[model samples]
Each structure stands twice: as structure tokens, then as C-alpha cells.
Target: MFWKKFNLNKQYNILYLDYNATTPIDPRVLDAMLPFLKENFANPSSTHYFGSNINESVKTARIQVANLIGADETEIIFTSGSTEAINIAIKGVAENYINKGKHIITVSTEHKAVLDTCKYLETKGYEITYLPVQKNGLINLNELNKSLRSDTILVSVMYVNNETGVIQPIKEISALTHEIGALFMADATQAVGKIEIDVDDFGIDILCLSGHKMYAPKGIGALYVKKGIRLPAYTHGGGHENGLRSGTLNVPSIVALGKACEIAEQEMQQDAERIVSLRNELENELLKIPETFVNGSIENRIYNVSNICFKGCDANVMIGRMKNVAVSNGSACTSAVIEPSHVLAAMGLSDDYAFASLRFSLGKFNTKEEIKSVVEILKTELEFMNS
Candidate 1:
């Protein structure tokens, strides 16, 4: 396999362009987290030296998550990952405010985290409106306006599309949701480390983010809820996370996440400038090939992602032949589905176009040379496609 080198242990060198999927943990984050795993491990709720030390780390991590997204420290609650964070955000709101309104709104292009959560809520009798997107893969705001009713309690959208790297018009969408008196929730999973976010300016009531996508270890994330926004507790026990999410915190992972968030704040713009240029270089080169078209709004996308749909080759076959590249056919979540990308389908793309899609997400460690090499590898593989 092309990724065998990355799969194997030491000394292997393969370029990675899948940052929107997940990022490598920064060395600085690991250093800041060493003590928690080695010596200072504590159950943050306890009252002792071990606990006191962890208390500081947990508090610091909360502040770090808040700083990255421009939210208040008290508003951030620790979770297992963005999936759980999203679950808490959506389900929490659905159950808490169901009495006021049972209608919830979200776009069809949302990650499975939001969709599956809403699907579960649907079983509970909540009305969900899956808004359609344009051929370019953007949600229709006019349709959103029409969907909002007096009984609409929440509207959830993603700040960034994970597959295509398209950025949603969050500020405008937030304003629309507010006008209808519905609370707005955004899954900022793809935007947390790669883009800048100011919760107050964006006017989002709740947001979800993952640490692993921004260089923190997996199994640790946070959910941000604006002050005064009440959500019912889906996770019940021992009254942790201010009675919102009750669970023991992952100290080492939390510390790592906090440090990762700090790095994201300090380096996000520079990283974006570099990654965007590299992604463009790769995409521009792909344009030289006869059959490839960059998916979504190329000009209005996150710096770290590019979804390319090649004309003649199937992604399954092309994906296997790109021995010099590490990319995905669609999303990691739906890889097992073996079907055309749902994101592409929602954009009104034909099955051929959808099945031919590939996602190449760049990251901080990516370089110009790597971009050129990946493009060459793709070209070579495209030539090898029989059809």
C-alpha cells in the first residue's frame, strides 16, 4: 500500500496532506503534557495535591479551548471528542428547549456527527429540516429563512465543510437564526485549528471542536456554549462540567489539547497562508491534467483542504495507485460505505463525479516540495487509469 511507509515504524518519509481529517500532535503540546501522564495524574474532582495539580491543568485547558474560539472559559466543557461534543450540543439543546420548540434546522452537507444526532432526535419526535445546498455545495440562505418557524428552536451548521474545505457564511447564517429566535450551533471541528474564530463576533450560541484535528491527542475535545444558554445534560453523573457533561477529565490529553489550542491561536494565520498556497499549487497543477476539477468554492475555502474530482478514473482505483500520496477517497467516516461521496451527491454531482472525488487536506508540516511531488504522483496515477 502507498501508506505502508506511514503505517510502518521509523525512518519512513511520506508526505501527509490530510490535516482536516486530523493533525499530528505538536511537540510543544507533548512537552506540556508529559507531567500529567508521568507524575501529576489526578482526578480533577478530588481535593489533594494530585487533584490540585490536575485542577490547574483542566482549568488551563478550558481557557485554551476558549481562547482558540473566542469563548469564555466557563462556557467550554470537556468531552471525549468532537463527536461527543456535537452530541452534547445538539441533543442537549433539543431536549432542553423542546418544550419551547420542536423544530431544528441543519444543512444536508453537515458531518455525520450532526446528521446522526439529528436522526436520533427525529426518533424522539423532534422535527428536523435538512436544508439543501447549491450545486457549488453551499447552503441556501433563502431556504433557511423559509424553514425557520415560530416553533424553530435551533439551527446547526458547520463552520467548514470537512470533505470539500468550503467555509460556510457563518456570521450571516447566525444572524438569520437569531432573527427567528432560534439558537445557532456550529460544528467548528474543521475550523478550530485551521481558521480563526471569534464566538462573540460570529454570534454562535454553541460550537463543537476536536483536539485531534489541531495536533492534540485523540479522545479529547470541548463543547462551547454561550453564557446563559441552557442545555439539558445528556451525560448524567457526579455533576461535572458545570452539570452539563459529567465525566472524569482526560488530564494528559486535556493539557495537550490546551497547548495545541495555544499554538493554533499563535500560528493559525501563518499556517493558513502557507497551506493555502501549497494547496493552490497542487490544484493548479492538477488543472493542467485534462480530467480534474477542483470541487466546491475554490476561492472561498479553508486553507488546508482541497477536494478534487478526476474525470475518467474511479477514486477507488485511483486512490490505490497514488503510491506517492496519502489522501482519502472521501471522508474517513464513510470510507466503509464504498459508495459515492454524499457531500458530492448533495451538490448535484453525478454518481461518476461523486465516486471520483478525493480529499487532500493539508497541514502545518506540509511543504512546497511535498505539494509538487503529490501532484506528480497524482498525474502519474491518472495516466495509469485504464478508462
Candidate 2:
């Protein structure tokens, strides 16, 4: 166990395996944020001493977030969430680089944030190429290369698929995008704190990440724009975040996000080892049920996630049976829609199989005992289904 002794709130007593959807804020992160909420309540933009002190905290947050992704502090732009970050990265790039090209490339299995933003751009006369994924939920580099055009100004691919957890070949894709002088952007919401991510190492021109996906509060995220790359301002106001995003910073959440990043940097390796062990045990035991199989490229996925398909089992019904556990059929962002998962469909799953899938994303707080209990509950539920 990564945590020697941790106490979960009463409301969080049930097993939570939905880390990809959103993580529970770490107690330490909460502690770091409380001071900002209570005492340091001044606006960071004000010239007063209270504001200056808060502003300093925000700068510290910028450095912490930048350090996690190997970016410079000046390159980081604070946004409301990854959705806003995606909008800024895609739309800003489109606006600034439109003179060079009016085309964008992205994968079909991306989060709705990227896909919907691309669709919106299509209304503005920008051409978009939605690349297909293989049955293993992996993109074909050859197909991607073939899709690139001189007019392609950007290629937006996600570092990890929200449902399948399959990681993309970012380095290779970055090289391909750069060959045509286009910018490479990735939605790293699922990969950032879970895996070791260095934007410099990956040669990514723009990257988006959500604090809530790690152990931080929601409504806080950052976009890493490469030093030389210029993105047109998304919000037009006092020109905060290096004139890219404009607004008074959410000091409490910003502090929480920074503290969360610092902790993630320190405990990532240990967390991965322990979480992977629990996930493997859960997967192994869950697969014992008849007609069960894991989805996506298992070898190429993040350690904390396992998307499993229970053949002939309705995921909604399965979750209804396991009342004490928290899981999801797909991205929580799309939970309101009662249709089959778009991510699974892109991987060539039939509507039936897609609806039958469940995403089990573990986290640092999960323990061996919790894994065992969940596995037993699943076995019981499967038996009941057969009966």
C-alpha cells in the first residue's frame, strides 16, 4: 500500500474504481488549498499586499505544473478544465495558424472535448480528418502519415483513450506532424499524473491535462504551449496566463493542483507499482467469470486502468448489481448519454459489446483488500446473472 494509513470520508466508503473519471482529492491537497480559501482570499490581479501574496502562490503553482510535464513556467496557461484547455489549444492554434493551413487531424477515439472542438472548427471552413483506430484501440501510423497534408495545421491525438486506456504513439505522431510543419497537440487528461509525461521528450507542441484526473480539485487544469508556439487568446479580458487565457485565477484550486502535482511527482513510481498489482489481481479474478475479456491493447495501456467486456452482460445492469462499488461504462463526461460508447465503437466493437464494457480505473488509494472484495462481489454478481 502506498499510503501507510489513510482515512476515507464516510461518503467515500464505497469502493471507488473510477479514477479516470475523476479522483478523490488527496487530504494533503485539501490541506494545501484550505488556506487560500479562508485567509488568502484576495484577487491575484490586485496591487494590494493580500493580492500580491496570492499572486505569488499562483506563480508557485505554475512552476509546479510545469515541472510535472517538463515545461517552462511561462508556457503553462491555467484554464477552467481540460475542456477549456482543449478549446484554447485547438481553436487558438486554428486562429493563429490559419494563414498557413486550414486543416486539422485527430483520432476517432478521442474524448468529446477534442472531437466536438474539431467538429465546431469544421463550421468555420476548416477541414478535419478523423483517423480510425484498429480493433486493439491503437492507431495505424501509416494511416496517420497518409492522412497528413501540407494544409494540415494541427494533429490532435490523445495520450490515452478515456475508456480503453490505450496509449498512442505520441513521439512518432509528433515527428510526423512536425514533418509537415504542423503543431502536435495531445489531450493528456488520462495520462499526465498516472504515467511519466515529458512534453519536451515527446516533442508535443501543445498538451492538455486536468487536475481532477490526478488527486487535485476539479475546475482546474493547465495547457502547455511550446515556447515558440503562439496561440490566439481564447478569453478576452485582462490577459492573464501569458495573454492566452484571461481571468482571475482560482487561487484555492490552483494551489491544490500544484500540491497535487508535487505529490504525484514524488509518489508516481510507488503508486504505479502498487496500483498495477491490484489491477492485475482484479482483472485476473474478474476474467474467471464466463464469457469475459479485457478490452484494448493491454500491453500499451496505463497501469491503473483495465476496461473489461462481460460478454452478454449489460454494463448498466452489472453496475446496478454491484451497489457498493463505483465504476463506469465509459467516460463520465458522456454518462448522460444512454448510447453505446463511441470509443469502443471506434475500436470496432459491436453495439452489444460496447454496451457490455466497464472501465475499471484504479488509483493510489486502492488497496489489496479492496481489490479482493470487489473481485468476490463480481464473481457473486456473475453467478447471479447466470442463475
Model 2, position 83, has a per-residue lDDT of: 97
Screening candidate 2 with a backbone cut-off below 3 angstroms (N, C-alpha, C), the clashing residue pairs are none
lDDT of each: 0.85, 0.90
TM-score of 2: 0.97
Error of 2 at 331 (Å): 1.6
Candidate topping lDDT: 2
User: Which candidate should be chosen as best, given TM-score against the real structure?
Assistant: 2
- Which pairs of residues have clashing backbones in candidate 1? 17-361
- Mind giving the per-residue lDDT tens digits that candidate 1 earns over 78-108? 8888899888888888888978889999999
lDDT, model 1, position 53: 71
Candidate 1, which ten residues in sequence have the lowest lDDT sum?
1-10
Worst 10 residues of 2 by lDDT: 1-10
- The regions of model 2 sitting more than 4 angstroms off are 7-11
